[model samples]
Target: MIELRDAAYDYGGGGLALRGLDLSLAPGSFHFLTGPSGAGKTTLLKLLYGELRPTGGAALLFGSDTRAMDRDGVSDARRRIGVVHQDCRFLDHLPVHDNVALPLRVAGGDVASRADDVAQLLGWVGLGARMHARPPELSGGERQRAALARALVMDPDVLIADEPTGNVDWDMSQRLLTLLAELNRMGKAVIVATHDLALIRAAKAQVAARVLRLSGGALSAAGADL
Candidate 1:
């Protein structure tokens, strides 16, 4: 659904965060993005979701060049891609269910009519009983699952999770990985950006995935050791 051809991004004077990175994400494909801090994993994710267009090469969303897309075009393209940032950014004042539904509301979706769908999504993420709870009340694992639910609310074709298991313990991380694997089984393209080798290894046992490492402004297939 998305393709990056020799994609490159520069933060003005900061130099290129990413360069000559080529990638293609097809339906039901699974990928793991790994690198050290400041390796441009997040920058690559932004490019995939249309948050930042590539300055040097083409980044395409559903066949349209990101650089050529107008505001509305970019916005429309983003609706097909769901992102879970490292920090689960939820409105503390809103109930868990409300936060999950926020994207739909923002997209002008009829929240009232989609109540059942929203509740079902929460249940899918194992948060059915915590729907009424506030964000601050959730445990780290619960918060991550809630974030996943929120990302899936739009039923996007691709799911991009950045360091999804970073804060959770081993067991929780495994749980989250299983959830992601299950989603892939259901035919959603999944790209998880994490530095945890253990997490990636554990995932390999559960799903077939391409491990890509970003370093020195370039991307390459990870070796078997990964």
Candidate 2:
């Protein structure tokens, strides 16, 4: 459902983040993007979700060229893809339940309409008790879970995460990976970008995950194993 053909990105004439990178993500596939710091992992994810257009080459998402899409079109396209960011930002004044339900709310779906479903989803992510708590009151792990819940609220066809496990402990990281694996089994394409090799290794044990390492302005596959 996603393809990048000979993609290259240049930020303000700086070093190229990706050069002549070719990648395709089929439905229900699971992938882990790994690299050292400043290896362009985040840049790749941004291109995938249409946050940044490629400077050279082509990127197709759901068969539409990202470069040709208008702002509203890009936003609509993103609705089909969910994203969990490393820094989960939320409205501090809103309760956790409201914050987690913001996606549906902003999309014109009634928040009150899906209240029970939101509660259930938050519970699944181990954030049931924090529903009434504000975002500022949540711990790092709790905030991460809330962000995951928000991302999945739309039942997106694809899920992309950047450094999802960066702020969590090892045990929490395992829990998050477990949840993502289950989502992949349910047919959502999953892609995670992380610098944590151990977490990538653990995810490999649970799913058929291909490790793609970005380095020196190019994207290439790592070894066959995790």
The C-alpha RMSD of each candidate to the native structure, in angstroms, is 1.1, 1.2
Give the least accurate 10-residue stretch of model 2, judged by summed lDDT. 10-19
Count of clashing residue pairs in every prediction:
0, 0
Cα lDDT of model 2 by residue, 9-116, tens digit: 988666655789898878899989888898888899999999999999988989999999998888888888889999987889999999888889878897797999
Per-residue alpha-carbon lDDT of candidate 1 for residues 1-226, written as tens digits (9 for 90 to 100): 8999999998988765788999999999999999888898999999999999998899999999999999999998888888888899999999999999999998999999998998999998899999999999999999999999999999999999999999999999999999999999989999999999999998889999999999998999998897
The CA lDDT of each predicted structure is 0.93, 0.90
- Model 1 alpha-carbon drift over 4 Å, by segment: none
Candidate 1 clashes between residue pairs 3 or more apart in a chain or in different chains: none
Models 1 onward score TM values of: 0.97, 0.96
lDDT of 1 at 6: 97
lDDT of 1: 0.93
**lDDT for residue 189 in candidate 2, whole number 0-100:** 93
